[model samples]
Target: MALSVVGVVLCALVSVVSSHGYLSSPASRNSAWRFGFGTQTNYNDNELYCGGREVMHSQNQGRCGVCGDNWRLSEPRPHERGGVYGKGVITAQYRSGQVIPITIRISANHGGWFEFRLCNNNNPRARDSQQCLNKQLLTFADGSRGTRYNLSRSLRGDVTVHVQLPPRLSCTNCVLQWTWVVGNTWGICSDGRGKVGCGPQETFVNCADIQISPKRGFQKPTTTFNKNKNNFLYPRVSLVASVWFAGLVATIERDLEEDVLQTVVFLQRESIPDQDLFIRGGISESLRPPGCSSIVESDPCAIDMNTNLLGTIQHYEKYNAWRVGDTRLDWSGAQPGQDVYQGIPAEGTPLVWTTNNVLSPGYQELNT
Candidate 1:
């Protein structure tokens, strides 16, 4: 018992001190230091694979937190999205269909494979579920859709790739996630019947809140995805610039708070991400989760507001969802372009209606 106690204590220290690899560029949610978050940050942002196999294989049954958090908890922790972290901070911004280079810093190289996925969830008040991110798997924009990272062979430190954001897709707060499943662990098969070099292994993830907007000279494409699975959205896109919100609400409540619910209706500009938050959703062919496209249900102008009462405090049961909408549209030190929802719902702001003849609902609000 004493030995086991010592071992457990040692493991906890290791969890905080050392991690294999992490997303160093574009500022992931776990790694970046936002003023709103104070000093509350995950010291071991890279070591997040269900607390290693001891917890992953034994306790959680291969489950993982959407943003590389420990799987033992029933829900995401405080540092996770929708978990009352830095007010759903937006770290970076990019234009849809632009190729941007992503850098991964490997501290301890464990031969493995990594993948990048995005969930265009605009609401800054909900957890970024794994089911939602699975729908849109990102690929290298250089025509390498089914990208197989060659990390398993030699141990390299930094790996950078240029990827293109989906065309014609925009979001106020999108979760840009990077997951790396380690390839070192050897284990028995699921049946426990046969041995394998790569049955189950440690996984790591890091996420960043990002905003994607329409390009200056871009027009909405009428064409659907290409037949070839490799190039799902568009043909090979050359390197242009780069990459990139929403998650949980607040734990505390204020006595009086002012808010606004707005919509957008413009696609022809240098760029217009401010009014695109509610442009995508159950347009409901698939039975995916709510806010898959955008929280507001449909866009250039989505409301992202729900049935919550306008001017009064309410119980958890009083809101459509405890997680969908937020109080503020901006963050503390928001960068110029990274600031999405710029002219968004505030106390004094009035609700924005869709432009005439834009083929939109009269309004798109019903979210938080």
Candidate 2:
């Protein structure tokens, strides 16, 4: 009719920009991440009383939103209490190393025997926070994923504590919870719940915000048109395996067993004020203790300098590879510079990334 209604409004604007670039790719931005509530669940878990799927049964399943009953889904050892929980209380706060999981819902008939100690909110209550710490990060109840000690009662409703925090301790006040019931007991709780002292209302479900950047290597710029020559030197590595940022893709097995010899410099884009520029050649060196068999300096440099910025974000998606130079040296392998002005001797000393513009405060020494 009128150019067919302008061709159906340009095909609905190209199907809403191609469904927002396929749900913002990167594996759909890890399921569209959007959950931020340290307290969401007053009660509701009798298996939905009959039907099911309303709230409180998680291995990443359902509920935590809103629903109520005797409230089911709190099993690490909560029937009353048992074993496996050395001590507790942690309050970490860094931001962006990614490890946020947290889920603790407790209300077991409200009795006595209590000892719920899940850490990393600052961890240091006196040399190992009083010992007993078993690792795996605790989170039990048959559903497995460690860190939720045994508050034995035979186990049932109320008590879902799952913790995995890295993103610099992540903050909206950066989550923290530790409840060791009845004498020898500990404190420090804040992941939802303002005032409910008869004890039975401890909710904190942060879920996702993990973008760890402990990155390491993937060097590829002797300068010449910079195309990633031979690629696989420090090829790729970035982890958090579960909620996003996988990008492994490495290769260079000089007989294999962790043999690449350092070379981690990358940055095809993503320049948060010059986020590091680019430089890599086996970061500094030191340490080698797990059985020890040579390859000593201990073991510092390997993969993960943002794994070629996620392979240049899978072919130039956005960029995020920063780590070019300035004493942050934590690598330990490669050392052979004949050119590039001959100054290639940094298996350790070099850390300078922060220079896109605004050069004041003497560039604040690149914020270290």
| 276-331 per-residue lDDT for model 1 (tens digits) | 22211111122222333332223232223212233334322222122223322211
TM-score of every candidate relative to the true structure: 0.56, 0.24
Whole-structure CA lDDT of model 2: 0.26
Candidate 2, 1-368: lDDT as tens digits: 99999999998666322211011111111112212222222122212111122223332243332111113434221111110111211122222333333333333332223222322221111222213222213333335555435444444443433344432221111112233222111233465544323322223221111122221222322222212432223334422222211122222222122321232333232324545324333321223223322232333322222121234433333222122222222333322321122343334322222211122111221221
**TM-score of candidate 1 to 2 decimals:** 0.56
TM accuracy, model 2 = 0.24
lDDT of each: 0.52, 0.26
> Which prediction has the highest TM-score against the true structure?
1
